[model samples]
Target chain A: MPNLRVHNLTVSLDGFAAGPRQRLEHPLGEGFEGLHEWMFAAMRDRADGKTGIDVEYVERSEENIGATIMGRNMFGPQRGPWQDESWKGWWGDNPPYHNDVFVHTHHLRPSLAMEGGTTFHFTDEPIETVLGRAYEAAAGKDVRIGGGPATIQQYLRAGLIDELHLAIVPELLGRGERLFDNLGDGIDGYRVAELVGSPAVTHARLVRR
Target chain B: MPNLRVHNLTVSLDGFAAGPRQRLEHPLGEGFEGLHEWMFAAMRDRADGKTGIDVEYVERSEENIGATIMGRNMFGPQRGPWQDESWKGWWGDNPPYHNDVFVHTHHLRPSLAMEGGTTFHFTDEPIETVLGRAYEAAAGKDVRIGGGPATIQQYLRAGLIDELHLAIVPELLGRGERLFDNLGDGIDGYRVAELVGSPAVTHARLVRR
Candidate 1:
């Protein structure tokens, strides 16, 4: 069976996956970039032909992800009804995701086919239904939960996520949307499969047992 | 100089040092024991003639501290004018701390001396004033910040804590008292000096530059 996974979901020390007031300008809100400095540096190192645990983890995030399912917020900042249909997401031409990307949204919009063999499919279905759609789109490969915290929280609370790789940054974001809110002992059954530490971040991979 | 330090403070993946609704039965709150499983195991190992990073960290928590400063909540659950004067502490007869421990409280109370060199000095003074008293009592030795989050938060916010050693547990406590709450970019001045990952806990020591 293809595993449903979440990889490299960066969170602040206070467990905020995204800082408050996420908009087009901020993307991850004010000062939240400090949370992903390690990944950004790793990406830079990868561009410079360097390979290590951090680089490997960054690369491995998209290893078997045949399809991705992200929330509407992650698609863009425009909410309560799509204002502009011209919005092709933050990713410009040749988006990083080169496969079927499923977006969870309430409004109905036609499927969008972008460059580099990527396509965006919007749906308002339940998580399981979306997972089913994602599996079919994945074609036997793994399904990636591209989270904005609320989406991942739903999957976690429903015991749908199989693996989670969290990058915990050692900075406090004070006030923001907390990822672990209302989890209610949801992380009890999971065990730490692996843990790696760097000067910038601590990577923890948890597997549901 | 006697460095003011916080050592072996355990926080969940969600950054909560203690769970919600602390009561007499559950000191660390319900299910919070999972956060300190590594510490509990380390204590057992210490009794069984074992030594490692976990044990070392636990042992080092009390290494050179001659005095401790804690909040009234850490002392007990008593609130508003100390209903029971006979209530010494959770530690019966002799407490683990073998030095002068200052308890921060709004209400005034007399100093109570327990066995094994542990004396609870109740004071409503400011953190700096209390630290001064603790320094005098410590007699050139290091002063420890024995935390219940709020106390440490105060010291941390005031830039009084020189060093902080935090144990990041792999579990998620949905609701509780967070250690990093109201610490807006409070950890920016500190850097991770050391990080060690064991099976149950990942220890990160932060030092202010």
Candidate 2:
């Protein structure tokens, strides 16, 4: 089964996912940059830089991605009628999402063909429809729910997810949108399947019952 | 001068702000509990004890936050049809947004009030109009545009911001939302006024031209 998973999200000790008043030029928010150092170092240059992090974690975490679900805002920081579609997907000629991709939006625009294997499907269909599309696109591989928080919350509430992997960076975003403000109390059963603690941050995997 | 600043926001190198498929129960989306080692460590030691993150960052970031703006999805994953008027703003007894919050929605709803200083003002208003209202409600303090992604991009494109701070955590969502995905051109002339390479991430100031 291509499990529905929410993986690799970041948050502050104070429980913020992103800061308040996020702007296009700066998406997170001021002073909130401290929330994400762990990822940059891991991707850019691991301290070891070689035989770093357990192979299983890296494979199941980083290189394991199959298809992506990008919310409209994640596509760009624009509002009301895109500016001439001049905005290609955020990544350059080769976007980070190389497999099939689905964009969630009410705007019925044509699919965008990017330079690489990435093509964006704009859907007015229900989220379940999108999830199914992405899953089929994944072809028995796992489907990653690329979130803006709200997107993830919707799926989580629908009980559509299976696993959640996190790279626990050490930091705090005092304020902004929180990943778990109104959450909890509803999630009844989950078992911690894996845990990795490093100097920069910890990594853990949570699987639903 | 109106400073185009990126304040209090954080990002991982892989550029996934929040985890994928966020929900009310697991708001941070799967394993996000790993992201807040510092905060959790501090708060965890003693259930109801105070943390060292400072009252200013905590109170100002969450308490004094005058107003907020979020994408429609950010407000609730549900779309179309009034499921229940009971879905007051996402936060409960004390939502992070304690003042007036203008939600951007094509589908409109009446203004909502919560326990704390939070109010949900559904606006079909333009992004600028929402910003103006939010700024006014903030009364020269600061207004936070909580991210769904597109909400923040609109402000940046309009050049209506002052400061932006980013916390770069280490992790690869490989997919999900990219905070800077569709930004047009370089914000140009912006300089780093402050930078923190410690505390697990790099916190930097982005000042306008």
Candidate 1 reaches a DockQ of 0.40
DockQ of each candidate's interface versus the true one? 0.40, 0.03
Q: What docking grade does candidate 1 earn?
A: acceptable
**Candidate 1 lDDT over residue span A1-209, tens digit each:** 99899988998765688988988887887768667788889999999999887898899897888999999888888888887699988899778889999999998699999999889999999989999999999999999988888898888877888998988776656667887776656766566677667656788887886
Question: What TM-score does chain B alone reach in each candidate, compared with the true chain B?
Answer: 0.95, 0.77
Could you tell me how far off, in angstroms, the CA of residue B20 lies in candidate 2 after the best superposition?
27
Best by TM-score: 1
At residue B67, give the lDDT of candidate 1: 96
lDDT per residue as tens, model 2, B1-209? 11223334655443456666777764555444465443334335345564443222323344345567777767876667767777765556677666787889888888887767788888888877888887787776667777665666667656665665555454433344556544453343244444444434444445565
Residue ranges of candidate 2 with Cα displaced over 4 Å: A46-49, A54-58, A182-186, B1-209
The candidate maximizing lDDT is 1
